[model samples]
Target: MTTLRLGFARGGLEIKQFLRSRESVVFTLFFPLLLLVIFGSVFDAEIAPGVSFTQYFAAGIIAAGLLTTGFQSLAIQIPMEREKGILKRLRGTPMPRTAYFIGKVIMVLAIGAAETVVLVATAAAFYDLPVPSTAAKWVTFGWVSLLGISACTLCGIAFSSLARTGRGAPAIVTPVALVLQFISGVFFQYTSIPEWMRTIASLFPLKWITQGMRSVFLPDSFAAQEVGGGWQLGYVAIALGAWVIIGLALCVFTFRWTDRG
Candidate 1:
């Protein structure tokens, strides 16, 4: 109970810091909106029969917003903190180290939730997006959002160990994330992407997350466009679960408090 309280307080501070940081705000809030509006309006026509491009595209943008917030942002922030001795200083503080990480996870949760709202609201207002209507659909959205954010956040923490300097952080993380975004069909409908490319994407969390979102937002008839012509809910759960485990293990193994080396 005490630890939970401490983590909440620490997380509150992190939220304030996020609000103050222009880069953080823009990426978390603006970038996803930009992508949605630009791509959605331009590709508003149906590339897939019976599925409006906007409807097909909105859900994936929500996942992208969450991924960019938790993965890309943390990848940059963690390495910069280490390089600036922020992590070292925090270690010397009286607070539990776990609280710092909890704080980061909370930051991801807050931003990811906000991003979801923004994407859904924008899509509905501007693009006439179809929302999750059933109780089951909402339930699916809940679990998908939770698991996706957690996996991305943990992966970000693990990948943070890769950057040796503050300047190197973006160079290291952005390309990997951008490549995944391209392959994972964040900016395009997965069905239109090549089968081999989809296979490459299926190996990662982003693809599953986007698929899960599609399962919730798209109509039952829309399943034909999917690789298996179904939601593949079991596969989504398993793939994301595996990534969560792998990410947690990697973070435990590779975490560094300082860049003294």
Candidate 2:
């Protein structure tokens, strides 16, 4: 109970510090909005009879935004903090390690949710992207967001240990993220991509995350455009659930308080 309280307090501080940085606020919160506006404007064609390209792309952007916040941000932030001895000092404090991680998860959830709201609003306002209209759809959106965020955050924490310095963090993390975004249908349609590329992307969480978002945002008939020719919500849940487990294991084994670990 005390730990949870401390974790919440820590999370408040994290949010404050994050908001204080103009560059981080712009990049982490609004980068997806920028991408959405650019791509949503550039591509005006319809993917289906009633579904505009903007509608389809909006779902992908939301999924990608979650990835950026939960994965890429932490991947870079943790390593930089470690290099600065911030994490090392935290380790020396009375706060339990679990509490520290809880704080990070809270911060990621807050930022990711805010990012999602911003992207969804922008898409709806300018691009005519529809918000989930049913309770069932909202429920699907909730679980997918939770699971995706968990998988990405844990993976980011684990991956951060690989960087020996702050400068090295982005070098290692950004390419992997960019590649996944491209292959996972964030920048293109999944069905339009080659079978081999789709097969490769299936092994990752982002593809499933994007698909889940599509399921919530797109019409039922649009499911036919997916690789499975359906939303495959069961498979999406399984894939993301598996990654949550895998990422948790990796974080336990790989996370280090300092560079010397």
Candidate 3:
């Protein structure tokens, strides 16, 4: 109980710090809204002759927010903390070191969940999209959203070890994330994309997350063309488990408590 409280307090502090950053808010919240505006407008006219652009855009934006909050933010911030001696300072406390990580996980999950809700609500209200009508689909959305955040958080921590400075962190994380988004079928339709690109997207978690989100909201006809046979639960499990193992291994091997180089 004490350790959990410690973890929650630590997580709360980090969340407060993160919320104070204008750049962070811009990317985390406004960027999705920006995409929602531009792409949502472009695809407004009965995309695929019956499909709702609002529904499709909602899923893509949610996936994008997850990546931004879970993966990109961690990749940028962890190395900064290391360089600033925050990790080193924390190590001297009586608190369990895992508590810090646990806090971060909790914080990011909350942020991701909030982003999902905001995007969904916005879509439903102004964009004319309805929430998932079936209980099964809502359940699927919940699982997929959780899995998406988990996978990205793990991958982010793993990648953070590679960055040496905060300055280079955004440069390193953003371009790769953008490339993944492009190929991930978030900004583009999967059917219109070439077969080679589809194969590439299938190899990444971002694609799976977007596909999973679409499965929850879109019809079966739309879902079938996505990779992994329409959000197969097995694939989400496999991808998440693999990333978790890799992240844990990297954290054990290279994650440092001190800024000392």
Which number leads on TM-score?
Answer: 2
Which scores higher on TM-score, 1 or 3?
A: 1
Please give the lDDT score at residue 111 for candidate 2.
97
Model 1 segments beyond 4 Å from truth? none
Task: Give the candidates in order of lDDT, highest first.
Answer: 2, 1, 3
lDDT tens digits, residue span 1-261, model 1: 666777888889999999998977997799889988988888888756667878777888888877898888999999999988999999888888788888898888998998899999999898877778999999999999999988899999999999998789999899988878887867777877888998999998999999899889888788777878899989999999999999999999999999865
Residue pairs in collision within model 3: none
> lDDT per model, in order?
0.87, 0.92, 0.80
1-261 in candidate 2: lDDT tens per residue? 989999999899999999999999999988899999999999979889889888989999999998999999999999999989999999999998888888899999999999999999999889988889999999999999999999999889988988889989999999999999999999988878888998889998999999999999989889987788899999999999999999999999988898773
Q: After superposition, how far is residue 10 of candidate 1 from its true place, in Å?
A: 1.2
Deviation from truth (RMSD, Å), model 3: 2.0
Backbone clashes in model 1, listed as residue pairs: none
Clashing pairs in 2: none
Which model is ahead, 1 or 3, in terms of lDDT?
A: 1
lDDT per residue as tens, model 3, 174-232: 89899888878787776677889878877778887887788777777775555445657
Residue 56, model 2: lDDT of 87
Q: Which lDDT value does model 1 have at 156?
A: 92
- Candidate 1 Cα lDDT to native: 0.87
